[model samples]
Target: MKKIVIVLVLIGLSVISAISLLKTGEVRPTRVSELKSQFLEKATARVDHSKFPILQIKAASPRDLTAACLSCHNKTAQEVMQSNHWNWERPEYIAGRGIVYLGKKNVLNNFCIGVDGNEGTCARCHIGFGMRSARTFSYTDSTNIDCLVCHDNTETYAKAPEKGGAPEPVLDLNYIAGRVGSPKRSNCGVCHFYGGGGNNVKHGDLEEALFEPTRDIDIHMAVDGVNLSCIDCHTTERHVISGKMYSLSSMNRNRSHCESCHGEAPHADNILNKHMLKVACQTCHIPIYAKAHATKTHWDWSTAGRLRDGKPYEINDADGNHIYLSTKGSFQWGKNLKPDYIWFNGTAGHYLLGDVIADTSRPILLNTLNGSYHDPDAKIVPVKTHNARQPYDPAHRMLIKAKLYAEEKGQGALWVDFDWHKAAEKGMQALGLPFSGEIAFIRTQMHWRINHMVSGKDQAVACTECHTRADGRLANLTDFYLPGRDRNLLVETAGISLLWISLAGVLLHGSIRIAASRRNSKRG
Candidate 1:
């Protein structure tokens, strides 16, 4: 009986230890507080949301929860209403199509194509409620704002896919509303990380692995490292968060930058610091991306219609990332991918709707990053260039947006019916644009800028990696003269000749000095 009681006490102690470990996973505990509590304590609001009488009621709809939030913070809704997250379009000066509003609404990308016809599914990412088609969706309605999606601390708040951006049915709105606070990593990542359907598919740098990254994966966001959150760098003002991917944002204004926090002279080395003049910080710091998971590098939408036995099938790679899907297409995923370096100014140009494809033979750059060595603002940056083979119209000589997802599937959705012609016609019809009856495939590329998962300073790019003659990083960039890689034969020969001449002079002078010293010693 005594032995049994001692064993039971040991089991209880073991259970408590396991629970403590579960709370603090790999995160290093601090002297004052655990890592999780450190972030929460920093985000402590003036008033406890639990004390509010209005939040106690069980809301019938998510809209009711938004109304309750607006009772006190009414101005926030108006600010979010005008922001790009709500509108998804901004007035931008595309080179040929000057000052036209361009965004996900009209811009044609290589991944999922345009979102004009598939607004219901695409609205999953939009921070709003009850967004249907482009014509029916109310842009002026401030009440459509989803305050809990961003503010909910419970992290239970999630948008149901294909439901016009409605909250999941099981989520207790009352419980979630009472725990509202500033947005956390999980809040922004729910949409951003899951873009292009799955994890790390859209942006190669961003993935689910960043949620609780190791020190080697990301020095900033690592629980053991600096322990920074997304909002720490992307500071918000009124509802507009800083930072813009050149993918959506065209204008250079309101951009978040590393230099904003870490000065231009972040490096202690003079040479490395000087490199900042022409090289962006990300080029060296984030040497490789998709560190923990594979990202979609090449997507072939032409091979999407293949089925196993009347039913669509899917195939995954060794890493469990989808390689082939009957709905999407054959995909080539890459992990620890070295980025394609490009010179980029803050400004960029994008391929808008109705733009005729001039040269269909060569792969089209869906969005062109405007820069060169000559441009003062231009800096060499690492970019993940996602290549794709997608559907386009031969007659119209343009990329066609195929109707993908519907609230109710199999109406004209490409994934449901697998009819390219019908889907193209339906998609173009919704956009009020002419579609050619003929369908063809064209090769295209989209460059996504890598700015996250920054490795430690010690793991930065070595000098020889970019400077060496063989497999040099700057091989594609030939416009400017790089001292190590770029030099004329005459200069090389002259440098060698001068070097030999200096060595001979030193040798002769030393010999003469030695002989004089011997003669002086003999005379003494």
Candidate 2:
């Protein structure tokens, strides 16, 4: 009886420990308040320039970042040491701090399945050679995001730095004027823009041409007079892994931070407004059309049903992971049927026409199904759903398939389906420049402008009134627009036609004059 009681107690203790560990998993215990409080305590301490020379970074190598700065600056080093920035270009996860949060299971690290042949996405952000270097005959340690990599004013900073001498750090009043605080773009931009051999280069362009002193326009690092620095937004906080100025941490991780600036949300979502609350504010209230503004994690699988091959496509748990479709079936795609979908139905998964796929490569296709159908609102849906299962469609079957493969299989191919930049490129192909995805940008802003003028006559012109989703996200447009109201889609049609006609008239006049001159010459 005594032995049985002891065994039961041990079993209970084991279960409790396991449960506690599972809950905590990868969530580090360092609270936002704690990080903030510690930053404040250290930020108060003045930098003793005499002890830590400003010129010390001039000779430092990329690998000498921690050693050069951390030795003298313990608190600041500790603060930055735990940051994703510090661990940016390195392949190994820094212990105690600076861990990458790529789901509980890091698919980037090959689902943490031991870094051997492929060092995962470590080199993309790390300072060493990742897989390519590892495979080479002359391989060393992974490249670290060293301080000198960006700050050293010796080696030329090129897109590709094949020539290995350190580039010169071009200092202007904007960067070295001490006008801006620490952690501004000038500092962060150095590593963020150029570090890890330019891995995290997204959203904004950082090319030298974009920032030529002569040019009046530069979108990414643009200022009215001078360039911006890293410290401008980074402020004093460290361990900053979150995206943009709107991140919870950027607003100081406090609810008051949001309310104080914006006041109460004009369209605050609550339990009463279930649909509105579920959707993020950015979906509707986007201020700008910045490409890298925000990203949706889950793919829009609402159109997954359209991928059906007409046959009874069986859902297989072949790998014990659920992915609605698999390639191990008899009726393999591309091998036999030449799908009619336009954009994403090709053999290589590229936008090409008439390519034959004689083998199975379980490519994902998008819904290229096109036909004007009335939505739930009884309004005509303007969206072009080109059936990917068909051929020559603009829908992305390969991308969807890639995303699914990543989800089901612990690892996947090195290619990602669609980034916003890639999406912009696609939009550019469809709609010419100066109008590439910029239409979506303009349309989004137009909605906001209309919403802001809600009190006035524009209240009736809100997006929900005319262009609404099937869901209750949109208000009924019937009362607002009087039965059939779609005047906006044809808004610029007349103006465009008039512009083309005017150009043609001018060309005709020129042609007549040239023809008459030729006839007169023959007569003379």
Candidate 3:
């Protein structure tokens, strides 16, 4: 009876130990479950914007809706007015140029030249109202703010390009006002995706397709994936959005990088994690850009004004891309394009207005990525190289802003008359600058940093792509020496010669040792 009791006690202890071990080893929830829980927590905490009194009434204009919004959120207008989106200007210090004000308002681009004389059309992208012209526009007016542009969740709010930043009259302001909430991908895509007057023209990475992306399109923004919105990464504070483009920014502005969400070390491999020091996350993640549509890679304004049968004509390439448009110019479109690699530390050297040109013969670099292999903060980043041949003043040595559109008939617009001289003269007059009267086309290049269109891990660039070839993605990069791809003939010859000599010495020594051993054995 004592042995039986002892055995039973031992078994009971074993059972208790096993149960404790099992409890300790059991995984409560997986990563998927944790993500689901987090999503549920957020879903339960959502607020209904319809309950607000300001959004209850019907409004005529976007400004009126904004006035209603300001009644409650009075500081919101002041916060937005201070943002780059409203001001269209940001002060920054350049390398050669000292502290200067730069933005779309001042910076000259190949597309639409500059916003100096075209504020009305360009103001469609602006966050303000009644920006018909630079002279008449008031930046201090808080009532000019458009709150529905970023906050509307109804998806019905839209600003007409020709309406001087006003919302369409047909839209139900009350319905849209009631549905105002967090900004969606579609909200941001309205202007950004259609920049340069068309879809996928300005920023190659951003497109309308991102509104409802699939897992294969973009892993982060995909509906089937994390389904992250633009605001998730572009975390805004005081109505100022983060992530300024290098071309637009001069100073080292605050930006939301991959490290903001993904830690410094996100890879499983230590080797790959170490690579993050010199390799940008987008360099490998976005293997190709313009996945959804073919983006314009080249534009030649010199080729414009070509007419067939006294009417403007257009030519299409083999891939059905617009090669020539009578109104704009010849274009080169590309899809699934490999990015041009560059060393970047977030700083960009922009060609500000009145800046001296380095080379007049070759394509002038509008903006160049600022970094080197020696820079510890620099990394190899991918960029979209947009080439263009646009109008420039030969005498003033500055890019010319041609007046392309006008509300009236005799406004000296280039599209109206097909005369470059008149358009240049009118544009310069509007800007209050003297025209040299000498019009010439010069090749120019702009490097657009690629940051979106993230692919799956399996679609990343292979190791051999850059390691084995001289003309690889990193071919232009000469900051560091690659082993297999870059080799010195003298060093290779010396290494080969030393290897041969060492092999010969070893063979002779082994042969002599073998013969001596056989001789010793025979003597024994």
Best TM-score among the predictions, by candidate number = 3
Could you tell me the TM-score of candidate 1?
0.86
TM-score of 3: 0.87
Indicate the worst ten consecutive residues by lDDT in candidate 3.
Answer: 36-45
Model 1 clashing residue pairs (backbone): none
Ranking by TM-score: 3, 1, 2
Every model's TM-score: 0.86, 0.32, 0.87
Best by lDDT: 1
Model 1 residue 45 lDDT score: 82
Instruction: Write the candidate numbers in order of decreasing lDDT.
Output: 1, 3, 2
1 or 3: which has the higher TM-score? 3
lDDT of 3 by residue, 1-524 (tens): 99999999999999999998997787665444554455433332176767887788777667888899899888887899888888888888888877888888888877767887777678888887788886678989898988888888879899876778888878888888877778888899998888887888887899888889897778778888778889878989888798888778866667878887677887756788888999999999999999988899999999887678878888988867778888788898888999999999878878866665667898898887799999987899999999999988888887788888776657887766677888889987877676789999999999899999998679988777788756788888977986557888898899999999999999999999999999999999
Give the C-alpha miss distance for residue 480 in model 1, angstroms.
0.9
Residue-by-residue lDDT tens digits, candidate 1, 404-455? 8765656788888877888888888887778978889999999999999897
| lDDT of residue 67 for candidate 3 | 92
**Residue-level lDDT tens digits of model 2 in 473-508:** 223223233223334546568878889999999899
lDDT (0 to 1) per candidate: 0.86, 0.28, 0.83
